[model samples]
Target: MGLSSRPRCQLAEQYGPVFTVHLGGQKTVVLTGYQAVREALVGTGQRLADRPPIPIFQLIQGGRGIFFSSGPRWRAARQHAVRTLHGLGVGRAPVADKVLQELRCLVGQLDQFGGRPFPLALLGWAPANITFTLLFGRRFDYQDPLFRSLLGLIDDVMVLLGTPGLQLFNLYPRLGALLRLHRPVLRKIEEVRAILRALLEARPAPAPGGGPVHSYADALRQHGQGGDPDGLFSEENVVACVLDMVMAGTETTAATLQWAVLLMGRHPGVQDRVQEELDRVLGPGRPPRPEDQQALPYTNAVLHEVHRSITLLPHAPRCTAGSTRLGGYLLPEGTPVLPLLSSVLLDKTQWETPGQFNPGHFLDADGRFVQREAFLPFSAGRRVCPGARLAQTELFLLFAGLLQSFRLQPPPGLGPAGLRTVPAPAFTMRPPAQVLCAVPRPRGR
Candidate 1:
């Protein structure tokens, strides 16, 4: 996963971009390359928007929440989430301020290491705290027990979801149920649910005036009180939504940052270039802003390359909402579709150098940042990620702010090549458990 290539490249070349692959008893259509995957997602629109029942998630959410739910329920949950996020200033200056605050917290934590090696997992703390702030209207201290516990549970669930036993259970639910393969995951899930339930219980009722939701919890509360006949905002659904939001909102940006840091540490030349750009644009004393991305083209390209290279949520399988023609093939209703995003990001025809860590892919000869058509890190269509803007803002400030403050590199004894880049097998393509040193940069320019 840490490598710049995907095996699906060969598969697509041999079998064409669109082909059917069997995951145990399930037959899922795999869409590879930019054109094929985009057709299934952007071209087909909502026809491929629904999520098919994956056994583990079905057991966990019961077709509730934004990520896995379908039909009217999913639509309503997603719409409300988008509105709530905007109301809370997710994509605006307010969000940049909040993210910058969290970034300072992260930088402080990293500084405490005093040039000693620290686990890369520490990078995730900032993004997770941002999500927590949105969900609970507050953030947790780095030493808080609840914060550590929630992160531990999330880590456990992510690793468990990618385990072979769970994969088998997802493929053959009834048989795996008899063999008891799902108990571990369910146990971890219950632990997380208990924490969230307590949090929801502790929330004071939404204040009068039906004002815009300040937090995700308040948003769900308002949704339920709107006399929701469909019961979309029931207690259980709210819990599911919160969990989904936390899991989805936190993991992607966190994982991508991990990748960015590692990539920077691995390629010192590239890191030097990015630092130079940061120094030139914002100088040593000023903090990085989201708006700085326009002026700092090299740093911006580096971040975009991070997203393009990792392709975190590669196979976020979608279910055919109805019978439709995709990539010249007819798919029946409910056909599970694997829109292989990794394949698209690394498409030979799309990227100039598909297997190298080059930021020039996002740059033109004029040395300005250029958007590529294949940079669909957030996916597309009706089921597209609602938190895209928030994620970008978080990434921009955190990445820029960190490099602006500290020089990221591997441990003293461990050189760049000594650091392992292969992602630990997890639901998300997160950097493997590794260590890096954040040496404080000089105060004077």
Candidate 2:
């Protein structure tokens, strides 16, 4: 089945442009058409600003983090995070430099594989490392015990969220609690929270007369002082916010990178074109810079294509703040609403040849790169992904740098490129396990 044939997108397309799905006793209105999504997410504003209450998130984060929380707590935390990211130069040169350094390290690691089919598991490490640097003012060795533990925790949480049992629990929380079946999941949450608490506590204190610390932790500390002076920036909030950053920043970016390599292996001609652009713009001896992106239209287009093909996180779950009209239907306040992003992204109305992996979707008649309003990978409106800018910077740098240094291919004996991606659903969608051979290119090739 094609990617769009997945149950979620299929349901969205079949149920008119906007309709409600009854899950347990709750009603979730899902928006499929572009106009409907805009109306629900942007036009109504705060009416659709709240998030659906996920029991797992509540048990794990205590509903204190920016992603799940609402009202004053969410506003303060989200504002602080955005401001802190700006202060750390997230979309500027300093952050780009950091991303480029990690990309270089990643290229070196892939080069070590000597064109053999190496697992892409290692590919996840670099982006996750970059996130750690931004959040804690430090990076970890690939084999660091703490880093490995954090990755494991992330994986477990994602699996739990995706499991059918969890969905059933979300639908019937009282029964789940009565049978004592959720105890294990609760225990896992506590364990992860404890580790996060320790890490936040152990973070180094700012030095005397420090002008501004560049880490996410420093931002939290600064915000704690004035913004939430009454203890709203408590240790729990700090831990939850930091964990949210690490999980959101790392997992989604890494998964996209993994998909890019897989797609390149399946379509060598496209891969070659990307490499050609990298060579012409970056040359062989030096690494690619963020500014060089303007000169490499095809490479940029390919990255956008990968994002479109792999619609990360089928939809963004939201809730209505009050009774509002969307798609001519009355949606009551607190009603869950899912803006089906994949539908809008792959809608034939918006994209030409929506089913194919064509980079031209992002290009103009003259081959110049162009932006599409329907590109909602980060979703739209006030509740959009906070790491959107940061993730875009990382994706471009890492993808271009890798293609610049090596050519990815399948092992000779391996069968036809298996584009089959395992659907590991979570707060974000993830790719299944896969590997590819990364063959290093000769200098000045």
lDDT of each candidate versus the true structure: 0.87, 0.79
Instruction: Give lDDT tens digits, candidate 2, residues 1-445.
Output: 0123256567766777887677677766777867777777778877787887877677777778888888777878898899889889898999999998888778777777888888876888888999989998888877789888888787777666666667777777887677765676667666777777787777876553445786998778666665456556877788889878877887899888888888888888998889877887778877777787789999999999999988877776788888988888887778888888888788888998988989999999998999998888888888988888988899898888788778888776764365556555554567777677888888533
lDDT tens readout by residue for model 1, 158-208: 999888788788888898899999999999999999999988888888865
Q: Where does model 2 exceed 4 Å of error? A: 1-5, 8-14, 179-181, 207-210, 227-230, 425-427
Name the lDDT value of residue 237 in candidate 2. 85
User: Could you give me the TM-score of model 2 versus the true structure?
Assistant: 0.94
User: Model 1 clash pairs?
Assistant: none
Query: Among these predicted structures, which one has the highest lDDT?
Result: 1
lDDT for model 1: 0.87
Which 10 consecutive positions of candidate 1 have the poorest summed lDDT?
1-10
